[model samples]
Target chain A: MKKIIFGIAFLIFFSFLIVSAINMRTFGEPAYSEMDDYFIENAQSETGANNVVTSVVFDYRGFDTLGEATVLFTAVVGVIALFRGVKK
Target chain B: MKEMSRIVKTVTNFVYGFIIIFGFYIIAHGHLTPGGGFQGGAVVGSAFALLLVSYGSLNSQKFLKKDILSLFEGFGLILFIVLGFSGLGITFFYNFLANSGGWFGNAAVIGVNPGNMNTGGVIPLMNIAVGLEVLSAFGVIVLTMASAAEFTKKKEKS
Candidate 1:
């Protein structure tokens, strides 16, 4: 009975995934790409970085990177706290 | 968490330095290349993991100081925050240094030519700060886990 239920659930999940994949938009052709176009065209002159992705990440979208750094720091703090008892 | 065999240790010694240097290269060249701080930091972190696995937790402690790593992590985060605030004269996270004719201020070629190393402004600095934080964080986590595992194993044996 459990195997039958599991198989049904698996099939349902995979069907959803397959449907989405089949209906996915074409690659490198986002519907809303005005911002992307701007960045690609002007990032070099504005940020002086050769890599547009890097400029977007570290310059234009710096807040997101800050949040990521905070999350990593918090995770490290948690790990250290968990293992505090083992330290001499 | 006993040390690996001599062959594994030898190989790690031979390779870890290069791995670390390559990671630094990625981080430093992040503005010009495909990688950035996080990707390069992960690469360096893997080298620390390699060191811990081959040398054992206890033996690795001499070099992988947890306190120093923690300090560096804190320092990196603080530096990033400070840099963010530095641009408040215009706005938060402003590119104040770009094209300023100062350090890292040279204008890049309009289109695709060879990338200049001295082109990125605050981006490179931020990359270094983030890279340092990530590498240290990885080292601390790996060291802590290895030691914890060793402690648990000893308790089990007893």
Candidate 2:
């Protein structure tokens, strides 16, 4: 019974994944990209970072990075709390 | 929780410093290169994990102090927020220093060119802040997990 249920679930999940993959847009040429053009043209002069990806991460979208840091901090806190047991 | 083989310890001693240096290089040159704070910090934290795995819980305990890791993590987060607010005259996370002819304020050429270190405004500062926080957080996580495993092992043995 368990095996049958798992097989059915797996088939359902795989079909959903395949449908999403088929629907994905073509690589590189995004459908809507006003922001991409602006960044490519002006990020270097504006942020003064030659690596545009770094400029986007650290400057244009810094709040996202900050949130990432907070996530890491929270994970550490939870791990330490869970593992505070003393060895016998 | 005991130390690994002699060969593993020997290799770890020889290789950990280089790993740490490479990670720091990635963090420092984040604006000029592909890597940034989180990526570089992960690299360094992996090195620490390598050392802990090789040297065992006892020797690792001497170096991996929970309090110190917590301190560094908190300091990094605070510094990042402070840097963000420093640009409050403009806006949060504003590149107020860019093109101002001060430190990290040089105007970059609009087209292709070699990268310069002193060119990313508050980006480098943010990178450093995020790097420290990540490095310490990773260290703390690994240390706690290992210690918990050791504790459970002892509990089972008893």
Candidate 3:
């Protein structure tokens, strides 16, 4: 019974992944028609940075960057706390 | 795998040098290329990890210090926040003083490209801060793993 349930779950997961991969290939790539060009053009002016992607990540979406940094900080703290005092 | 011979070690060292240099190149050129802080920082961290593996951690300790790693981690976070706040009066992360036209043509006052490299806005500084933070974090992780492996090995020996 356990084996049957596990097999069914694995099958479903694999099937979903395969379907998504097939769809992605068929679609080739999704166009970001709304803000892609705008982002590329004015990113430099707005962010005062050369790289458009960096401008987008660090400046235009600074709140998100802060969140990302906080996540990294939390992970580091967690790791340090977990492995605090195991002498070699 | 069998033990690495002298010739193997020499070849690996050469490859490692190339990898480290290439990673720095990517990090430096991040502002112009597709790669940026996170990817380039990870590359550099991996380079250090390679060194730890090639030469034993005991030997690598001469170069990698735990205190320095902690310092870098703390400093990186502080620097990032400072840079962020420097733009507070304008917009957050705003590039203030990017177009001041240079104070007497010095690199410190005005940027080389105004909007490109040599711009002392938050971008380059942030890149470096993130790089340090990530490299230190990766070092800590690798150190933990190495210590765990050593402990397990000692247990098996006993």
Highest DockQ among the candidates is held by which one?
1
Candidate 3 C-alpha error for residue B10, in Å: 1.8
Report the lDDT tens digits of candidate 1 across residue range B1-158.
88999999999999999999999999999999999889999999999999999998889999889889989999999999998999999999998999888989999999988799898889999999999999999998998888899889988999
Output the TM-score of candidate 1. 0.91
Q: Candidate 3, TM-score vs. the true structure?
A: 0.75
Comparing only chain B with the true structure, the TM-scores of all models are 0.97, 0.96, 0.78
Model 1 agreement with the true structure over A4-81: per-residue lDDT tens digits: 999999999999999999999999889999998999899999999999999999999999999999999999999988
Interface root-mean-square deviation (Å) of every model: 0.8, 1.7, 4.6
Docking class of 2: medium
**lDDT of all predictions:** 0.93, 0.88, 0.68
Ranking by DockQ: 1, 2, 3
Q: Write the per-residue lDDT of candidate 3 for residues B56-154, one digit (tens) a residue.
A: 766667777776887888787778888788878977776654545452111232223433465434666677777777777777778766766766677
Task: Candidate 2: list runs displaced more than 4 Å.
Answer: A1-25, A85-88
lDDT of 3: 0.68
For model 1 chain B, the run of ten residues with the poorest summed lDDT: B112-121
**Lowest-scoring 10 consecutive residues by lDDT in candidate 2 chain B?**
B140-149
Model 3 stretches with alpha carbons more than 4 Å out: A1-32, B1-5, B102-116
